[model samples]
Target chain A: MSTEPPALSADRRREVRRQALSVGAATGAYGISFGALSVASGLSVWQTQALSLLLFSGGSQFAVVGVLGAGGSGVAAVLTSTLLGVRNGLYALQTSRFLGVTGVRRLAAAQITIDESTAVGVAQPERPAQRIGFWLTGIAVFIGWNVMTLVGALVGNAIGDPRTYGLDAAAAAAFAALLWPRLRSGDAAATAVLAVFVALVTSPLLPPGVPVILAALAAVVVGLRRGGRHEAPPTSRAGELPGADPVP
Target chain B: MTTWTTVLLACAAAYALKLAGYLVPATWVEGERRSRVIALLPVALLAGLVTVQTVVGDGGSLVLDARAAALAVAVGLLLLRANFLVVVAGAALTAGLLRAVGWG
Candidate 1:
């Protein structure tokens, strides 16, 4: 692929921005659920907002809140969140070459390089649009997500019992949604199934957070055992929004 | 540690990992064998989370409750390719209704 950015027609430029904004809006809107779920799990509204502003990755944010809600240790929550955030790192590796960001811009670029922005950035046909798609989607999501998170946290705080609104179940559904797309292959599916069993079996004996970590370790073993087999790397599917549900 | 400390530490770790990608050499994450493992890490952890959330109850004892039913609803919605909000709403509605009706 040529590194040179083809000159975009004005229409193309507008089109890319439109796509970026729309993707940002859609993904950011989901932050409401995150906020509600976070507070229900016992975080203060400000803490929930902090996760949105600082952690920023949708999947990682949910993982942290979910673990803590389940009575997991803080160590467990951090480890789980870190594991989920690894994908964002991989995404950065892919985007950094084209992004060519530096100093403060580099830091800013790193902050917003989650699944949605990376997906939108890579989906564009032209180089300039890629950058535009990345930045616009990142900024838009940043603003929209934080605002919606505050709204959701406030509502959730006001609502009293989370179970009254099934927020617990909502958290489960979020995990299921994130897991669904990753189950594209037999090996991935097998890993998930086994991981679930491991988690369940160990839950009664181990601490809240340890079971998930053990399950992740199991997946590493599986991955290595099956490593040489031909399979599409998960990053190739980066075109799909990381946390976005599949369109019906 | 306090939840506040945990939150900050986790956020810091997440940011560090993201920044590492930009600063570290590409060769570190290169190679199919290693990358494939990296890819499946979330799959495993997420599946574990879903299991724990859906079935494990107080003291981590396995219990089939409204959450299980709600998860079933979530699966059905997912099969129909419902968007994220719809799936979550469907699960929450299902669980809430079940709880209202005195079911687990």
Candidate 2:
């Protein structure tokens, strides 16, 4: 693929930005849930906001709050969250080459190099629109998520005990929902089941983080055992934004 | 680690992860085994998290409480193909109702 960005007509550019803004609005609003849930999990509003501002990865942000909420240590939360965010690293591979950005701009691109941006970027038929879509979506989600996180945290804090709103189970529920998409594959489902068993067996005798760590080791074993098998390396990422191109 | 420490450390590490993506050679992560492990890691980690959060209590013992019911409800929604947010809300409502009925 040529690295040079192709020119786009005005109409297409407008359409792309429009789509970006709309998706950004919707995604930003979803930050309210993370904010509320994080607060419910006992993070202060600012702390919740920090997760949004700094980490900037959606599922990973949820993982951090969820892990900590369930009394898992920081190490566990970080490790789990890191695993969740690794896909962005993969996305970054395509993104860095495509964007051809460098210096401070490259660094900025890295900060906003999330699933939403990458998907938006990759989905565009034309190269110019791809760049625009990437930036617009990233900026939109960034502003939207951070601002709404503060709003949600305040509202959640006002609600007193999160359990009243069933927020106590937010982490598990969210993670379960996240897991659903992976269940489409038999290999993934089996890994999940076995991991659950590992988690359950270890929960009785281990620290909060250790069980999850042990469970992750199951994947390491599976990955190594199946390493030589032909599986497609992912070209896209896990960002499930509306209207983004479906990754093959 | 304290929550503050956790937040700071996590933020730094996360940024590093992203930065590493830019700096690390594609060939390293491009290998079949490494990519496979990367893809599967989240599955195992999240499954464990979901299991622990739903079934394991603070004392680190299995406890089938409101959380368990909530997860079951969420699974039902998932089976029905509900949207992600809807699944979360459904779980919350189910757990809340169960707790209110004093069944949990």
Candidate 3:
């Protein structure tokens, strides 16, 4: 048996860089909306900038600002943000295998494993491509998001009513953009539907962030069941052929 | 809570969640069951988020207002497989039209 490891050649590295740049452009442009809305939600420029730099997850930042704007308690805001951000943990697990780095590099890899980076990395066909994709997208998003936040905050401050300019919808639009492609698959579509159903049905019964968590759990159950079904005998081979060959 | 306290707590919680995944030990992470569940986690989580934002937002009052209309337009755009920018613009335009029409 051959023991040679799968290696990404120089051309593949260039392709990874290109993919990263594309994802970065999309993610960075989306950040403009977050920055504008964070400021419009009554957060100071410094506070908005801090969120972009430290929090770094667009979903969490939007949730926090949305809660705050709605007059929710600070605790509620934090909890909401935390709940939305929980997805990054999942991304971390998926991306870590591609990193192959140890010690400080591993730590750095973990730090940058957000949605954009994870998506770009996971989309690549080769291991080296995955690593390069992840880092480039992560760094690009980080720099681009922070810079756009500053710009949006300043503009939001000057404009006084982002609603009039339609800037407030930026986050939602950005999120929708991210979510749309994922819905293409049957399993993903089922999970999405289940999650929405759970959240909607349970929202009134639970506390601020509790419903979201419960909805996620409900989706997990559905996903697990779906996965279990796929693992059953006949479908096992089915999974290996055409469907599993596609990138997530 | 003070702004600093809130920020600190938020950052701490976010980091804690991130760290929890890493600390779960490679054995646990490597299991087929764990991998299957983790694969579905993001979809479920994001779906929950979208549902909450679109449906029950603010004071637990369900309003089919401008936001909802815009979201509907967005869904349509998404169905068409429109580019991201076009989809966003479509939603914004829907919202603006609703507002102009005194709907919300």
Best by DockQ: 1
Clashing pairs in 1: B66-B104
The lDDT, on a scale of 0 to 1, for candidate 1 is: 0.86
TM-score of each: 0.94, 0.91, 0.78
Interface Cα RMSD for all candidates?
0.9, 1.6, 3.5
Give the chain B TM-score achieved by candidate 1: 0.98
**Deviation in angstroms for A230 in model 2?**
9.9
Candidate lDDT scores, in order, read 0.86, 0.80, 0.67
Candidate 1 lDDT over A116-227, as tens digits, reads 7887887776778889989998899889889989998999999999998788988999999888887887778878988998998899999898898888975777788844
Docking class of 1: high
Docking class of 2: medium
Cα lDDT tens digits, model 3, A196-218, are 88877777766655555666675
Error of 1 at A228 (Å): 5.3
Candidate 3 collision pairs: none
Clashing pairs in 2: none
Q: Give RMSD to native, each candidate.
A: 2.8, 3.4, 5.2
| Selected candidate, larger TM-score, 1 vs 3 | 1
**Compared with the true structure, what per-residue lDDT tens digits does model 2 show for residues B24-97?**
88997877677767877778887988999898987799999999989999899889977666877888898888
